[model samples]
Target chain A: MISILKNWVRGSNKLERFWLLSKIEYKLRYYENKLGLVWALIKPLSEIFIYYIAFEVIMKAGIPHFVSYLFIALVLWNFFVESSLGTIQILATKKYLYEYTNMNKIEIYLSVIGSNLIGLFFNILMFFVYYIFIEKGMYVSWHIIFLIPIVLNLVILSLGFSLILSNLYIIAKDIQQIWLIIIGLGFWISPILYKLDTFRAALPGLEYINPISNIIINARNVVLYNHVPEWGLLFWGLIYSVFFLLIGLYLLNRLGSKAAEKL
Target chain B: MELNKEKVAVIARNISKTFYISEDSYNTVKKRLFNLFNTPKPKEVAALKMMNFQIDRGECFGLIGRNGSGKSTLARVLAGVYPTDTGYVKINGSTMLMNLGVGMSHELTARENIYVSGSVLGLKIKEIDKVFDKIVDFAELREFIDTKIKFFSSGMIARLGFSIAVNAGAEIMFLDEILTVGDIKFQEKAIKVFEKSWIDGKTVILVSHSMDVIKKYCQRVAYLKNGVLEYLGDAETAVNMYIAENK
Candidate 1:
């Protein structure tokens, strides 16, 4: 485990690989499209517009400051959904890469995560532009910096899930369908669409157990309320991320070689 | 670290790997329905059974075997891509090259794939950077360096992949019929690179169907039959044994 961790960190210069892969990922997505990177902005903006109409206007939820709340949640939710779904199929999707080359399995995991992050970063940049300029000078607070930790935790968690699911998918082909169901179920349970305060009265126990709930709630707290993350919940989220990461690495180390054979 | 001046670089002692071959693919509904009643049974296939051999440092070893002979299984085991069911592998240095260009993405450019692929072979970015230009020149894809590899022909991709693997600078290397791709000119260039790497004291293990390639490059060779090491000795002897048995 020590050797594996050592190799993961110092053994591979991740920064260089990350930069190269991120660029490649971006280029690949926009390779033939004339719109190219403009889609990055257009995509989220369109999503926000649709959601705003359906949830805020039509549903007529009487919550205070609902537009800003929905926009912020959308930003966070987009990162989570994109990263998780993207990461899940990364290994299986790139099976040809493993079959034809001598590249490390872990790097594939990193590349997907890195690629998603580039998109996530651009989304965040756009989010700020909309929030500060378009939304008419929403008060900027230092707590927005909390996005760093949130992004880091999301990356680790997404990678952990990707590694496990991808490896499992190799062994069990039906996992892709199972994963889709789980994600669909997870979105409702998660606080992405709803505020935790609304749920806290009915299901107080869920706040402790559901890691994503905590992440979403904390992100909202920092961004909307200018409050720090709850230390206990933060600790739990870290534990969840770390535990999944270790499990993912263990599976990768054990079965990564057989991936080519099985694929 | 001065390269180990010894003759033997890799020694596999009674290495074996067993794989569980499932009888059939089960859809989610079927698997769930079946799980409610009983667990599904998978047939066990012994992919490799107690295979053993030794390759000297700087020696180019050849493994010639027909499909389902466990040639790829052994290569994966040696590359630490799979753990052995039994026995072990002792290596003096890193086995850098295995299945070349495995895990590369077409969405990535030739330059980007090099780093991702190189790191998998344990090559640092600086080291890859040093040989980056040389690799591009060798692949002869300088014009399309920045273009996404998806745009390149399969042969061009193979050429770029081969260049990176050969130049990744591992003391030990494994090639599994990866040369079968690319044109004759590229194959010739690849052979020259293989020869140069071998002369520079890099241990090479090559699996190929071409008898001429085996005889010309490898000093020692092994033949695997039914997941067992059937023959091991001089390349010429093994080739002859393989030919006689197959015929």
Candidate 2:
């Protein structure tokens, strides 16, 4: 374990391979589309606008730039959902490369999460630009710095979760179906569409247990509310990320070369 | 028939692998949840059973077996595709699985797939650029290099795949039934390359059902039966035993 960790830090080959694969994967996602990555933004923007029409214009749940506010959190939520579902199929899909070459199987999962992150990063940039510059004077503050940790933590959590899901998915494909239901339920339970402040008051325990709630709430705090994410919660989130990562590594090691069996 | 520098190339010791076939192949979450009430267990089949063998450096070896006799499984295990159940497989030098379409992407053009598969075979893009023309020339697909592989005939794709795998410069090459493909002319050229360098040096393990090809090319051969090493010795004897058993 020490040696493996040491090699990861010392060697750059794995990182290089990760970059090559993710670059291809990211490019391939929009390869066939004539409009290219505009489609990536268009799909989410359309969904957010529908919600905006219902909540802000129609229902008068108007709380500041509520549309962009809602968009920011929903965008982050989509990243997790997309990354989770996408990562589940990475190993099974790329079985040929990892099976044939000396390439590490974990590279498949890493490259997938890495590739999805580029899209999520762009979405965040677009939303923040519209929120701060175009929409104007929403009390932008130093708390915006927390957005860095927010994205980093999301990637870490996703990688950890993905490592576990992709490995289990090899043997028991039922996990994918179960994951779909969990992801569907995840959106409702998390504070993506609703206010975190309300959830904090109404069901504080849910906020603590559900990491997704923390991520969405943390994103909203930096991007919209202009407030610092709770440091204690953020610390817990880091620990949560580490725990998942360790568990993911454990499960992957347990599966071993047996992963290619079902494939 | 032995070279002076007869170093050990591959030492495979007591390797074994078992695959579990789920009773319900399509066990979705709904069915699995239901199966919790009245469950059926996955059935395990040992694909390779405690097998030991070695191939010398600069040797051309053939693995022959009946279908499902673990010939391909052994190659895959040695190639590090599937992990063995319990054993050691130590192979010197870079290894590549020469099964046609080992990493061919149908959506990508033949040129693009060359890069994709070349990279998968551990070649940097720059390295592929240096040998790109040679690979294209060898496959004789220069005109259709940029055409998507899906549009190409099966033989064309196989030829392209074979060309890339061969030129990838793997010191230990594992050719799994790819030699049997392509035209007579191409096979003749491939056989020449085999006789010239494949015999001169660079260990090659060929897994094929063609006894004639095995007898013609292999210096020594190993015969597998139901995951067991049934025979390992002179090529002619192994081939005769294999042919007789199948008969």
Write down the lDDT that model 1 would get: 0.74
| Interface C-alpha RMSD per candidate, 1 decimal | 3.8, 2.6
Q: Under CAPRI classification, how is model 2 graded? A: acceptable
Runs of candidate 1 exceeding 4 Å displacement: A1-14, A30-32, A100-103, A254-257, B1-11, B27-29, B35-41, B65-67, B90-104, B109-133, B140-157, B167-170, B178-188, B210-212
The 10 consecutive residues of candidate 1 chain A with the worst lDDT sum are A95-104
Q: After superposition, how far is residue A104 of candidate 2 from its true place, in Å?
A: 1.8
Residue-level lDDT tens digits of model 1 in B133-161? 99889889999998888898877877887
Give the runs in model 2 whose Cα sits over 4 Å from its true position: A1-13, A139-145, A225-228, B1-10, B41-44, B55-57, B90-94, B195-201, B243-247
lDDT at A17, model 2: 56
Per residue, candidate 2 scores C-alpha lDDT tens digits across A1-263 of 99999886544344555677787788878657799989988978898889888877888875777777788887888888888887787776777676665556777777788889888878877887777677766757888899889788888888888888877886677788889988888777887666556767877688778887778777777767778897877888888888888888888887745666666
What does chain B score (TM) in every candidate?
A: 0.87, 0.88
Candidate 1, which CAPRI tier?
A: acceptable
Q: Could you report the Cα RMSD, in angstroms, for every candidate shown?
A: 4.1, 3.9
**Top model number, TM-score:** 2
